[model samples]
Target chain A: MATTPDLTKHRKMHRGSRAGIARRGHTVAFGQFGLQALERCWMTTRQIEAARQTITRTMKRRGKLWIRIFPQKSYTKKPLEVRMGKGKAGIEDWVAVIRPANMLFEVDGVPEVVAKAGMRLAAAKLPIRTRFVVRGRA
Target chain B: MKSVALEAFPRAAAKRNAVKKLRAGGRVPGVLYGREGSPRAVEVDQKALETLVHHATSETVLVDLSLQGASHLALLQEVQHHPISGSFLHVDLHAVRADEKVTVSVPVEAVGEPVGVKTGGGVLEHVMFKLKVRALPKDLPEIIHVDVTGLEVDKSIHIGEIQPAAGVEILGNPGFAVFSVAIPKAEEAKPTEAVAVEGAAPVEGGEAGAAGAKAEAGKAEGAADAKKADGKKAPEAKAKGK
Candidate 1:
């Protein structure tokens, strides 16, 4: 199913500025290993779900996974061949506005090698560059 | 407890700019406070501090800090690091007397593979990575080792069950789980079965079919009302335009 909030205060939202490094959710808190975003980007629900599936399959469902980012901002899209200037388009897909150093996924109860390999495959599914981080060390 | 000897220099400038300059010069600004005359501002070589941290087994590091010919036994209370770069920004050292009891959190290590994990296809999980304990300077342990060889599936080891070292007392909720061997989570159902289940439920209703039908009827009524209102407003808008 498509990921979207059931309730929202505002159905439409403006595209705001994306600046500054992530001050929180940057550390590996839940798991022993994590994938940290090195570049800022809007991660859609599909992308996050795809990465999660990749990580879970890589680990063979032996470990636990934590998804740190949520698609909070909803973006709008105009239909095909539609003219401009009809105010803003309807709400399309929701996206998580990720910043530098934001931790995207975390895995635990698995060996370091397996977690690293899983994160590498998951990073391939994402749009931004990522860094493999270990708990306490990073 | 292992003690590392490090030399520090008395810092003259504690201002933000001064601290920034000091960091740029490869020194980490720190404060030594506790049972002392006053909190002393000091700086240590960045590389040295990093090495000390890298070599330590746990977060609780006992430091033999020497500043301006005076030696003070201090605990590495806190270390602030850059979130992105993970570089040392500042350090806080707490001077402690050898006779006083100090409370600290020590990393917990599980020794040996659990029986459940080895034979029962269970996953061993470290629920609590660190345990807070109160101990004298000499009694502080670098790390606490817990044996989990006999742990069975769905079984947990709690803090109350642990026996600490002599002169050290575990401080926290006694019932807190430290380690457990859990049965792996069940896999998802087959796609066809999941789809069949989804198809059985009403598409528009939140849960009950009657409530869902009622909501759909309400939506249709609201849409008809909106269309009627729009039709009435169109003529008024045209007249105003003319």
Candidate 2:
């Protein structure tokens, strides 16, 4: 129920392997502290929602939370025992394509210690390894 | 040095959720303060603010802020953005006077291709992208241009070598290198005579024995030279690779 905005109307997408990230988006959005992905992986919408819920629950909604990524790409799967090459499988779930060095979440208006603890808890729900990062002084 | 006129209104409340309401209403929360006056909370039109910031040539922006029926000179200090949407979240402006000097970071740009890189098959490396400078608000430049056209292989341009505009002074160590022309890795990584000598040395060791060892040791100097050359070449490749 945490995941909303039904996107099932879209057609099935090709399952392309992970590609390396070429650039980090605009530097302005980087917050004081955040979680960075260390490897390429598909983050499901349910997983993102679960991680978000865990952070907000831990923080008690006292601070600002920014989900740096969105689950826009859809992953498809075939039914069990189905014959191959008939057609593409139906859409299974939505996912966000995460690459190494991409920031997953950012927290601000909160103390650094609390943000780190909350991000660590959120990281536990992710499929890929993550590292905590702080914005460097420019 | 160019001044931009901006209008802002005072924000009555300073709560965390107030920012959300302000954004929903198409306004951005900001603060204005510095040595010139007390800190004041203000808000500006989001579209106008985005245009001002987008067109700004440097991090330092001179704004003629019209607030409370008075105009004041200020500089754009810091801007915060929403991590996901990358939208403007907050802005901090520092009040300033035309006569006072302020220290700020200005972008450093290379104007031309280095002779070494163009002809000598070397790579141009930009060691530092921005330089800290001190100057009056009127004398601040949008960017500092360093001409690397004359730079040759193994030569570098240091901070001390740059001649800044009148009234502008660069900060930090003067000897720090801003840009350098380095030999490319492809040319440096090519196998040399020393490598061939080393490859052939071990094969002939059984017959020549001690003489081979002496010859190998003699060739060790050439290997060391090759290694030294490699050490110098690796960094340029790494820099370009990134």
* Model 1 agreement with the true structure over A30-90: per-residue lDDT tens digits: 7799999999999999899789877876786477788898898999999787688879998
Candidate 1 wrongly placed segments (more than 4 Å): A80-86, B186-242
Over B132-179, each residue of candidate 1 has an lDDT whose tens digit, in order, gives 999998889999999999999999999999999999999999998999
The DockQ of each candidate is: 0.29, 0.02
Candidate 2 residue lDDT tens string, A1-138: 234345446556777767865156423253457787877798998688778766655554244567888876777798786688887877788788887767888765356788888889999999988877765422
Find the 10 residues in a row with the least total lDDT in model 1 chain B.
Answer: B201-210
Best model per DockQ: 1
- Tens-place lDDT digits, model 2, residues B65-92: 9998999998888887654345788889
The complex in candidate 1 yields a DockQ of 0.29
Here, model 1's chain A TM-score works out at: 0.94
Candidate number of the best TM-score: 1
Chain B TM-score list for all models:
0.76, 0.73
